[model samples]
Target chain A: NAGVIQTPRHKVTGKGQEATLWCEPISGHSAVFWYRQTIVQGLEFLTYFRNQAPIDDSGMPKERFSAQMPNQSHSTLKIQSTQPQDSAVYLCASSLAGQNTEVFFGKGTRLTVV
Target chain B: SQLAEENPWALSVHEGESVTVNCSYKTSITALQWYRQKSGEGPAQLILIRSNEREKRNGRLRATLDTSSQSSSLSITATRCEDTAVYFCATDSGQGGRALIFGTGTTVSVSP
Candidate 1:
């Protein structure tokens, strides 16, 4: 298995521009999660989806950041009018079940908002 | 403040030596997990210890959890260069749905 596949791997965008990150979860996995990693914040959960439905997004910023799971196979995180502070590694993970299951993560997309 | 925090930002050890990393959490949790992330790679699960379980072992890795103190530990025996990575402790929020709260992580360097 390829585990989880995240596209682009790295992205650089001018401030105020939009950035979109994609993740393709492993086959048969039911839960997908998104997290942001930075030196200051460590690893923070942004949102999650189960069975193609958004379960919780309590950690996501109210503005500029949004996530969508259009299908069970893939999900996307979009940041509009990206700011320098938005730069961080966006990680996507999947688990076989919703709770108490081993989670597998993708390499992550390193976003540089300049 | 982070719900969970790992002690010792970084540590170094020679190959064949043993290393231990500690983690403490503020709130109650149903389970705690240990993950390791290598350079340019995503974190991978090492072990999962539930609140009821005090200790669990996987190969040369052992983890201990103290629910009363809300602390956990991971020990690796006979470390190798391949084991050099950043280790993190994640706690289940106990609200269910497997929402994990992660710690800052401990950077471990195992050298030859």
Candidate 2:
């Protein structure tokens, strides 16, 4: 298995601009998840999808952050009006199912909003 | 949000020594997992101990789960410098399709 694939391993965005990150989940996996990691906060869950339907997004910031899984194979996370405080590593992961399964993670996209 | 707290946020040990990291979680869970993440890399699942199981082991790594106390521990025996990395403990709550709630990681440094 290719594990989970995420695009644009590194991204640099001007302040107030937008950035979009992409992820291709492992084949046949039914669950996809997004997380944000930083030196200060460690890792925090942002959102999750099951079978292409969003299951929960309570962890996401109420403003300027959004995520979508248009199909079983891929998901995308977008940040609008990015700020320097938005700089962090965004990671995507996939698991065979939602319960009692081990998750596989992508190398993550390092977003630097300058 | 349910919290998973890990202790000894950072530890430094010499190669060949043994080290242990502890974690505690709030709320019941279906399973608890241990993951290792290298610098500048994604985290990888190392072990998953269901609530019913008390212990699980893989190679040089061993994990113990205590559902009664809502706690878990990951231990590395005969550690190698290559094992140096941040380790995180995550919980699967059996809800919301098994979304994992991760803890603040324990950074381990194995000196050569």
Q: Against the true structure, whose TM-score is highest?
A: 1
Cα distance off (Å), candidate 2, residue A47:
0.7
Q: Residue by residue across A42-100, what tens digits does model 2's lDDT show?
A: 79899999899998997899999999999888999999999999999999999886477
lDDT per residue for candidate 1 within A69-110, as digits (tens), equals 999889999999999999999999999875678999999999
Give the DockQ of candidate 1: 0.81
- lDDT scores of the candidates, listed in order: 0.94, 0.91
Which pairs of residues collide in model 1?
Answer: none
True contacts kept of each: 0.79, 0.82
Steric clash pairs (candidate 2): A98-B97
Candidate No. with top DockQ? 1
Candidate 2's residue-wise lDDT over B12-112, tens digit each?
Answer: 99999999999999978888899999987899999989888999999999999998898999999999999999999998644544678889989999999
Note the clash tally of each candidate: 0, 1
